[model samples]
Target: MKATEMRSDCPISSSLDIFGDKWSLLIVRDLMLHKSRTYGDFTKSAEKIATNILANRLQLLEDNGIIIKLPYPGNKVKGLYRLSPKGVDLIPALIEIALWGGRNISNTYDGSPFLKEVKKSKTKFLKKVMDDLLEEETNIG
Candidate 1:
């Protein structure tokens, strides 16, 4: 989809033309929240996104400047996904959504204790996520 073909001049609609679908944003959510960096990691998500859908969404995100694929330093044949600066900008939105859900959804988050802290301190949580991305070793003990 192109800006020229958008339904209207509404900014939200225009943005949706790129990532309006649940799968696209869910991919971003995974990247933001779970440190998922590879195709398999995304496939193993609880949502269990299908292989073909994941591939198409990944390509779509890359074309939109939301993410970039890089060759894994150790595995020549495998690729790792990383967020671009533009993608990093989505962190706050994710946090806000999470916090809202945390407040409204009962017995929410899958028993992750950190979520308690996140609901208390969104800034700190967002910082940690951003920092973790910067320190992407993809290989650690």
Candidate 2:
């Protein structure tokens, strides 16, 4: 569904309106897991997202309050992106998706020992990721 069109009032539909595209969640994943900040960092993802699509997804995410664009003191030309609390809250979901893929999908990651802990305790992992995201936000903001 298009961003402007509300398919339904369902929470899932609402979320999909903003991030159901191929690239948005990957952008989030990068920020949440890899500490990506600059446009250059996103463009460098292994999936090789197109510059135009990456730009579109970044704007959409920022508009939806899933992420915030921060000023980069080191580089005036490039913007820095960080997860808001709402975005940070998606960590558990990401962990679930990763665990599902790792279990059902072929050749997926075994993840790290930390990830094993995440699988056992999603709440704990969520808190950890949230804490880290907020700390990054504090340092940057």
Best by lDDT: 2
Residue pairs whose backbone atoms clash in candidate 2? none
Candidate 1 wrong stretches, greater than 4 Å: 1-5, 137-141
Global Cα lDDT for candidate 2: 0.80
lDDT values, one for every candidate: 0.78, 0.80
Q: If scored against the real structure, what TM-score would every candidate get?
A: 0.83, 0.87
Per-residue C-alpha lDDT of model 2 across residues 18-109, encoded as one tens digit per residue: 78877888898888875547998998888999998988888888877888898887878878888887888777777777788778988765
Q: What is candidate 1's TM-score against the reference?
A: 0.83
lDDT of candidate 1?
A: 0.78
After aligning candidate 2 to the native by TM-score, how far in Å is the CA of 53 from where it should be? 0.4
